[model samples]
Target: MIQAMYKRTKIGCEVLIQQAIDECPISTIKLYISRYYKKNNQRWALWARQHSPLLLQVTSTNSLESYHSELKRTTSSHYGLIGACHKVVALDQKQRTDSEYVAFEFRTKKISVMGLDDEILNEFHKFPYPIQRMLADEICAVENRIEKGKAIPGLTSLHCNCLFFIRYLLPCHHIFHEQIYGPTKLLTTNSWRNFQLMFEESGFEVYFHNELIEVDILEQTKAEKAAEN
Candidate 1:
């Protein structure tokens, strides 16, 4: 119950904790809850609301650190200034090419809908790309009400109760299930289109002015000295 409470919104969390305080059987549980969670529980759970949207599938920075480590392995302290510059330029070019390739794939490839029913697939297209991706990745069944045993009917009510959906304004996996089984439909929004455009335009060089004039000057000076010798 405590862990579940942590997953809820700030006000929802407070309400649940208050309920727990009122009904908990053990005095020590009540005392601990009052001391730790009553005052500023929001601070602990704020990241779920703030970072979950941007995080997507990543839950930690370990992958980023691992990439940095791999990059370090590819570079060497023994390389001269020109060699280092060339290496950096080569790596940058490779990354740019890879990014362009990914953008191309995203533009060209159709999302697979082999198993989804015709109705579900039609409804899926109504959602933005991010929401669609989220639904595809985290597929699940619609949750039943504990008291009623009836499935939730639509995305709006599910979105209201779901912390992830509310925080990000993206459909949660549960809502995806609701869409599949019920009359729930994800509405089209400018946010997804804007996001797609932003991603497609990322790393595109708007202006390319050469900034290696100092290196050019040094090379010119060396050439002159060599000619004189």
Candidate 2:
């Protein structure tokens, strides 16, 4: 079962079953295919799932350490579910306050522009400071990366197949290359259509002053104000 789970195609599963179990391999593989996979391609199969070989690059144990430690310190083992819920709400409020402070600082003290393309950098600056910082670092990585064989997922939109893009869902080196070298157009709110959006519609306000991104705040604010009410 363990080895069969790795098989992506029906044929692949049958071959594995044949190698392992000499009898009724065909029937066994047919049953396995029917039960194990949804569409036979979207399982824990090695090729289907996007993952990086570097463990630390994708996820880190230390990333949640601060939140875990704070939660642990605030909540006792003896607390009931309701008490624990209250502790979590308090902790969340504290973290949100800290985040708002950092965001305010980022807005007032604009981050240093690291990338060369003024067009993209202009868009990058509008996002929250944390997102701006993240994108700036990505641009630097792209600038230094040897682009001989960048794993471009597609050029239809700003998307890449690289581990970096897969992990962050941000513009990767390949997408940057498209804008810099290829015939790809400039960035805009509708840049990613039929794909994952980088930010919410409310976050689009950050692009207000950017000449390249033609976002209409006049129309947006009406709905935003209504939603808040």
Q: Which lDDT tens digits does candidate 2 get at residues 109-175?
A: 4467743666666666655566677777776766555454554323876556565665455676667
Q: What is the TM-score of each candidate against the true structure?
A: 0.49, 0.43
Off by over 4 Å in 1: 1-52, 55-59, 62-67, 122-131, 138-150, 153-158, 183-229
lDDT computed for candidate 1: 0.56
- Model 2 residue 12 CA deviation (Å) reads 15
> Model 1 reaches what TM-score against the true structure?
0.49
Model 1: how far residue 28 lies from native, Å? 23
Say what the RMSD of model 2 is: 12.4
